[model samples]
Target: MTEAGDDTWLARNRATLARLQFAPQARSVGRVEHVADGIALVSGLPEVRLNELLRFETGQLGFALTLDVEAIGVVLLDQSESICAGARVSGTGEVVRTPVGQGLLGRVVDPLGRPLDRDEALGETVFMPVERAAPAIIERDPVSEPLATGILLIDALFAIGRGQRELIIGDRATGKTSIAVDTIVNQKDSDVICVYVAIGQRATAVQRVIDAVRRHGAPERCVFVVAPAAAPAGLQWIAPFAGMTIAEYFRDQGRHALLVIDDLTRHAATHRELALLTREPPGREAYPGDIFYLHARLLERAAKLSGELGGGSVTALPIAETDAGNLSAYIPTNLISITDGQIVLDAGLFAANQRPAVDVGLSVSRVGGKAQTAALRHASGRLRLDYSQFQELEMFTRFGGITDARISAQIVRGQRIRALIRQARFAPLPESVEVALLGALADGLFDALPPACIATARERLLAGAISGDEAAAVRARLDGIVQDLTREAGHRPSDGASAP
Candidate 1:
C-alpha cells in the first residue's frame, strides 16, 4: 500500500510539471534611443499606444507622450539619471493611471500614483487613466445646485454652482490659494470630495497646505496630489490630470467632488518646456500652439452628470496667477475664456486689506441667480449695484465733503456691507449661519454698530453652541428669525426722507 501511494504522488507531481512547461510568454521589450532631461526617446515600441506606460530594463518608468514615425518620446515619471542611450525598455501596454478610492483621501501622492506620505503602499483601489474624454452634452444636466464657499460676498453675488468651472485669477501673494483652502475647509462634514493639486510648488509650501488641511479636520475628505517645484517638468505637467482623474472616479461613484488646481500657470509653463524639448513649434508666449487645448481638454471633463448616469458632479476651481494684475495676459485670458466665469482679485482692493479681495464689478457667475438659495437671492439683490454706486461716489467725495445727507447714508451702508464681506482665514461659515448674518445685515442689525466690530459679531453669531435634543429645535428657531428678517428686508422700502 505504501509503494502504490508513493507512485501515485510521483505521477501527480509529474503532471503538474508538464502543465507549467506551456504557459503564455511575457511582454515584448524595446530599446531606448536616448535619455535627457526627464525624457527618453525609445525605438522598438511601435506597438505602444499614446500615453501608454513604459518600463525600462533597469526598473524605471516613463509615459509615452508623443508617437513619431521613427521613435516615441516618453516622459520619465521618476528620476532619469540612471537611464541611458540604447537601454532596453518594455511596454506595460497601459496608459498612465492613478488610484482612486476613500483610501486616497488623507494621503499624499505624486502624478504617477506613487504614495509619498507613508513607507508602505496603499491598500488596493481602483485605478483610472489620467486622461479621459469629457461627457457628451446628452450626458450632462444643467448646474443648479449651489456650491457654497462660505464666503459672504462670493455666495451672495458670484455663486459657484455645482459642476461649474470657476477661474480664480489674481496676482501672486494676492491670496488666491487662500480662497481655495477656505473652500476646501468648508467641505468638512459635507459629502463633497476635495482634491487639491499642487504643481511646481515648493515642498514647504505644499507642506503648509497639508498642515492647514489637517488642522481644519478635512483630511478624511481631501486628497493632496503634489508635484513639487524640484520635480521634473513632466511630473508637474501631469499632476493635475492625475488629480482630476481621481476626482472623476469619485464622481462616477455617485459622489460630488471639488477639484482645485492651485495654479495652472505653472502647468502651462511645464508643458511649454516639454514642447520645446520635443522640437514642437512654439506659439505665443513660447508655449505650444495647443496651449489653449491643453487646458480645454482637461477642464471640459468637469460636468454634472444626468440622473440616469448616477447624478454625480465634479466642479473645477482652477487658479491662474497674473502679472501686475493683467487679466489680458495669454494664460489668464485663455483660462477666463475656458471657465464658466472668473473671480478677479483686485490688487488695489487687496492692498486696502480687503480680505478675500473679490472685485464685484469684475467677478460674475454666468450661472448666476439660479445657483443661489432663496435666502441668498433675496438678501443679495441690488447689493452689487448699491456697492458699485457707492464706490463711484466715494471717489468723487474725496475732493469735497458730502453736501447731501443722502450721499452720506449711502457711504455708511456701503461701508457696513464691505465690513460684512471681510472673513478671517480658516473660519468658513456654515450655510445656516451665513444666511442668518446676511439676513441680519439686510435688516439693519449692524447699522449702528461700528464697522470694525462687525467681524467679531459675525464670528460669535456662527460659533455659538447649542447641543443635544434641543439643537435641531434651536437651529430651526434661528433659521426662522433669519427667514423673517430676510423677508422683511426684501419687502422693506427705502426711506426717501433726508436728514439735515
Candidate 2:
C-alpha cells in the first residue's frame, strides 16, 4: 500500500477500536476480612505473594506483608480508617517500587517517592523495587578512599571510608542527628550525592534538618526521604529501604552517594508495631526476629563496586539511639556488630560542652588509617593516643594532686586538641585547614598560646590559608603560615617546627 493509504488505514482502525467497549481481564480479587491500625487481613487471593502491592476499593494502597494459608496480612500505606471489612482488594502482580533517578535530587519525598516539599512532579524517573539484593562480595572492592565527615574528630581519628557503614549511636538529645547533618553539609563541595532518610522523626525536627542542609550544604546534591512520626507505619518501615534504592541509582551510574538513616530505633519501633498489628510473634525486646536481618539487608546494599562495575560507591551512616548510654542494649549492640564501626557519642561529654560529643575511647573505625588521607594520617598518627592519655590524666588531676612537668605539659596539649576539635554546627573545615591544625599541634606550636586562643587562631588560619587545590604546595607552606600566626599572636613558634 502507498504510505498515505497505510496511514489512513491505521487511523481508521484506531478510531474504530476507540469506540468499542472492552472488559478488563479477570484478576484475582480478594475481600478484606479484618482491618485495624493500618493493617488488614484479606481472603480469597491465594496467589498473592510477599511484598506485593494490593489495591483497595477505597483507592488506598497496601503490601502483602505476611501470606498465610487462609489470608494475607496487608500493611496499608494510607489511612486505615477509610478501609473496612469486605472491601475489595486486588493484587497488583508487582512488588512495591519507588521512583529513582537524578530527578529526585534536592527533592523531599516520602517512602513511596511522592514529593512532599513542593507541588511539582518528579521529572523522568525509573521505578525500582525498594527491596533489592545486595552486591555480592566479588562485585565489591575494598574500601580505601576516605569519606571526610569534615568533623576533625572523625576525619582525624575515626576515619570513615567510601562504601563503609558507620553507626552513630548515643542516648537521646546527644547530637546524633547533628553529626549526620554536619556530614551532609560538608558534602557541599564534593561530588558525593547525599540521601538523608528521616524514619519516624518529628515533623519539626525533620524540617530543621532540611533547613540546615539548605543553608549550609548543596541542597541540589541532596535527596531527603522522610517518614515522619505521623506517617503510616508501613511508610516508616520502608523509609530507609526506599532511600537506599534512590541512592543506589546514582551509585550504579558511577557516582558516589551517601545514605544517612537519621535514626533506625524508631524504625524498629514501627516494625514492631506493624508486626504486632499483623500478629507476628515478637522476640527480643518485643521486636520481631527479622529486625536484624531487615537492617543488614538494607545496609549491605551500600558497597564500593569493583572496577568492572564502574567503581562507584555508597557510604552509609546509620544512626541508632541508646537508652541511658547503654551500649549493651539490644538494638545498639546489633548495629555495633553490623557496621564497620560505631561513633559513640557520650552524653556526659555532650553536657560538658563538647559539641560533637564523640567519645574517643569508645568510638572506633575498623577502616582505621587505611581510609585516612596521606596528609591526615601522617599528621594525626599519635593524636588519638595522646588525647586518650590526656583524658585519663586530667581525670586524676581533678583531685588536685601534684603532677610532674611532663604530665602538666601533656594535659595542656590535650586541652588544646580538645579545643581545636570542638567545631560549630554548620562549619566544616577543609582538609588543608585540618592538616595545618593537626601539624601545628604535633609540632607544639599551640603550646605557647593559651587554650582560649586556639579557637581564634583556628579562625585566622582558615580565613588566611591558601586553596587546597595544590596539596603539596599547601603542605609546604603550612609551617610558615603557622609560624606567622603564632608570631602575630605574640607567642614564639616552636623551634624548628615542620609542616605535615
Candidate 3:
C-alpha cells in the first residue's frame, strides 16, 4: 500500500467494474475515484496505475478505473454498496515478479513479467519490483574484471568487462542482434545468466531469436522478454525496465547477470511518444527535456555492486540501430557518452564481406584497460601500432610491383593477421586456444599458409595441437620462410648461405 502525499491527484467517476483482476494489469484502465488537486480516489483503489497495481489480486469486491487520471489516485464503483456517493481509492506503485529457483528458464514473457502463454500458469512466486531508482555511488564497484564473450577478436581487442554498460551501435543489418544472441549462447559455462529484452520488434523476429537461443541449449540460463509490435505502446516503454528488474533479482542473490536490450532506439521513440501524449515539453527531436534523465536513470541501474552489498553484477550490452548510419544523432551521441564504451559497427566494411565488419580504426573500447588482464595487454600491445602502419602502406602496394621485399613481406604478414581476426560461427574458444591463436599471429605464424588455409590453421589451433609458447617459435620461423619466398619471387640473389 502506498501512503498518500500532501497533494495527490484523484478522480471521481461512477462506473461498473469492466473485468475481474488484481490491481496491476498491463494496459488496463480503471474507473476514476474522488478527484483532489493531485490525489484522486475511487473507493478501494491503489495509488499507482491500475496495470501496475493489479499485481495483487485481492478477492475483495470493489470498483475499477480504466484511464490514468494524469495525476494520482483512482475511483472505484461498488454496485452492491451504496458508497457510490464518493469514496477514496489508493494505488501501490509496484510490479509483479517471478521467483528465482528452478523452472523459470524456457519461458516467454510480456512487459508485465507475466507469461504470455496462458496454457502454463506461473505458480505463486515472489514479486519483483520494476520501477527502481538509479544505484547510489556507494553501491557501485569499479569495473575491473573482464567478461570474455568467447569471440576471439572481441576478447583480444575491446574487451567487455562484467558489470560494464556497453553500447553496440550500428546501422541496420550489421549483425548486432546476432552478436548479442551469440554472446548469450556462448555464456553457458560462464555461470552468467542472460536476459534478452525485445522491444517493439516483429513477432517473427522474436520467435526466431527464441528458437536460436533454445537451439543452443541455453534456455535454462536465458530469460527472454518480448513487447510485440501490437502490444500497447506503454509496454514498449516499460519492457527494458521490467527485464532489468528480473536481472537484478539474480544479481542481488550474488549471481552474474547479462542483460541485452535489443534496440533502445525504439524504446526511446516510444517514450517520446508517451511523453508527448502526456503533454510534456518536447526538446530535441521531439523528445522530452528529461530525455537524458530518462535514459541515464535506466542505464545507471546496471552496476557491479560491492561484495558487502551483493557481489553479483550486471553487464549490459544495449544495442542501438542508427538511422542512416548516423552517429551524430541525438540518441546515439547521448548513449555513447553515457556508456563505458561502444562497439561501432561499420556498414561500409560490412558490405565488403567482412563478417563482424568491425572498423578496427573507428571501433574503440574506452574502458578496455579496466577489462584487459596484464598478460593480455602485454601480449597484444603492439597490435594497434602494427595494424595502423600496415594499412597506411597497403594502397601503394596494391598498384603491383612498387614495393620492396621487406615492405611486401610486412603486407603478407598483416594480411594474415586481418584474416585471423575474421570471426567464425558462435563457438566458445578456450583461453588457451585464444592465447595460442593470437600469440602465433603476433609472431607471424600464418604468413606461410595460403590465405585459403587460414580456416584450417585456426581449426588446428582450436584443436590444441600447438601450445602457446611454441606458437611464437613456429610463427617466427614461418615468417622467415615467407620473407625468403618473397625474395625468391624477384629472383634476388641470396645474401646468406642456404641452410643444410
Candidate 4:
C-alpha cells in the first residue's frame, strides 16, 4: 500500500512539473565610465531612454539626462560620493516619478517623494511622473475666478486668477517670499489646497515658511516640498516639477490647488551648472538653449480645466529674484514672459517704509478686471488712474512750492492713497474689508484723517464682521466704522474734499 501511494504522489508531482515552462530574460546594464559632480558618464546601456531612472550598484539612483551613441550622461539624485567609476548601472525602464495624492497633504517631502517632516508612512498612494505635458487650449477654460491674495494692493490692483501663472519678481529682501506666504495664510478658510516648493533655500528659511503656515494658516491642507540650498543640484532642479505633479493630482480630482515655487533663479543656476558639467553648449548667461523651454513646459501645466473635466484649476505663483531691481535680467525676463503677469516689487519703495512695495505701474494683471470680484471691480475702477496721476503730480510738487489749489489738493489726495495701501506683513485683509476700505477712500472718508488715523481705522475694520456677498452693505457699515474711529481720534472727516 505504501509503495503504491508513493508512486502515485511522484507521478502527480512529475505531471505538474512537466506542464511548467522556462524562459530566459535579458537586461541592459551599463558601467559608469566617469563619475563626478553629481553626474556620471555610462557606456553600455544602449537601450536606455532619456529621463529614465538608473540604478547603480551602490544603491544610489540617477536619471539618464543625455543619450549619445557612445555614452549616456546621467544626473545623480542621491549623493555621488559612494558611486565610483566602473560601477554597474541598470536601466529601470521607468521615468522619474513622485508620490501624489491626499496622502501628501500636511507632509514635508523631497522631490523623490521621500518624507522629510517625520518618519510616518505616506500610506497607499498613486505615483505620477514629475514631468507632464500641459493641458491643450481646448482642454483649458478661461481663468475667470479670482484667487485672492488678501493683500490690499494685489487684490485692488493686480488681481490674480485661478489657473494663472503670475511671476513675483523683486530684489533680495524686498518681501517677495512674504507676499507668497501671506497668500497661503489668507487661504486658511479656503477649499483650495496649497503646495509650497522651496528650491535651494536655506534650512532655516524653509523652516520659517512651514512654521508660518502651520501657525497662521491651515497646515492640514498644505504640502511643503523642500530642496534646501545644501541639497544636491538635481534635487533642487526637480523640486518644482515634483510639486506641480502633486498639485495636479488635486486638480484632476476636481479640486483647486495653488503652487508656489519660492524662487526659480536658483533653479536656473542649477541648470547652468548641470549643463556646463554635461558639456552642453552654453547660451546666454552660460545657460543651455533649452532653459526657456524647460520652464515653459513646467509652468504651462498650470491651467483651469474645462467644465467637462470638472472645472478644476491650478494657480501658480513663481518667485524670481532680481539683482538690484533689474527686471531685464535673463531669468527674471524669462519668467515675466512666461507668466500671465508680473508683480514687480521696488526696493526703493520698500526702503521708503512702504511694505510690500508693489510697483503699481509696472505690475499689471493680463486677466485684469475679468478675474476681479464684482464689488472690487466696481470700487477700484478709477483708483489706479487717479493714483498714477497723483504719483506724477506729487513728484513734480516736490521740486517747488505749488501755488495752484488744484495741484495742492491732488498731492493731498495722493498722499492719502499711499497711506491707505500701506500694509503690514502677516496681516492680510479679507476681500470684504479690502472692498470696504477702497470704497471708503473713494468716498473721501479719510481725506482729513492723518496716516495714523487711517491705520487705526483699518485695524478696527479688520476686526469687525464683514461679508463679501453685499458690497454696498459692507461699504455702508465701513463708513460708520471709519467715522467712529476718526471721532475717537479727535479728528473730523473733510466736508467737501473729493476722492482720490
> Least lDDT summed over 10 consecutive residues: which range in candidate 2?
467-476
- Return model 2's CA RMSD, one decimal: 3.5
User: Taking the tens digit of each residue's C-alpha lDDT, what string does model 1 give over 302-396?
Assistant: 99999999989999999999999888989989999999999989889899999999888888889987888887788677778978988898899
Query: What's the count of clashing pairs in each model shown?
Result: 0, 0, 42, 0
Q: By TM-score, highest first, what's the ranking?
A: 4, 2, 1, 3
lDDT of 4 by residue, 364-468 (tens): 899978899898898887888888999899788788889988877778778888888999978888787788788778878887677677887788667766545
Write down the lDDT that model 4 would get.
0.89
Of models 2 and 3, which has the larger TM-score? 2
Worst 10 residues of 4 by lDDT: 491-500
RMSD for each of the candidates:
4.7, 3.5, 11.3, 2.4
Residue 251 alpha-carbon offset, candidate 4, angstroms: 0.6
Local error of candidate 1 at residue 322 (angstroms) = 0.6
The residue-by-residue lDDT of candidate 3 on 70-164, one tens digit each, is: 44322211122333324322344544333433345567777655687556965434666566776788988888888877776677778888899
Tens-digit lDDT track of model 2 for 352-412: 9988999999999999899998989998979999899989999999999645877887888
By lDDT: ranked, best first: 2, 4, 1, 3
lDDT of 1: 0.84
The alpha-carbon root-mean-square deviation between model 4 and the true structure, to one decimal in Å, is: 2.4
What TM-score does structure 3 among the candidates reach? 0.76
Highest TM-score model number? 4
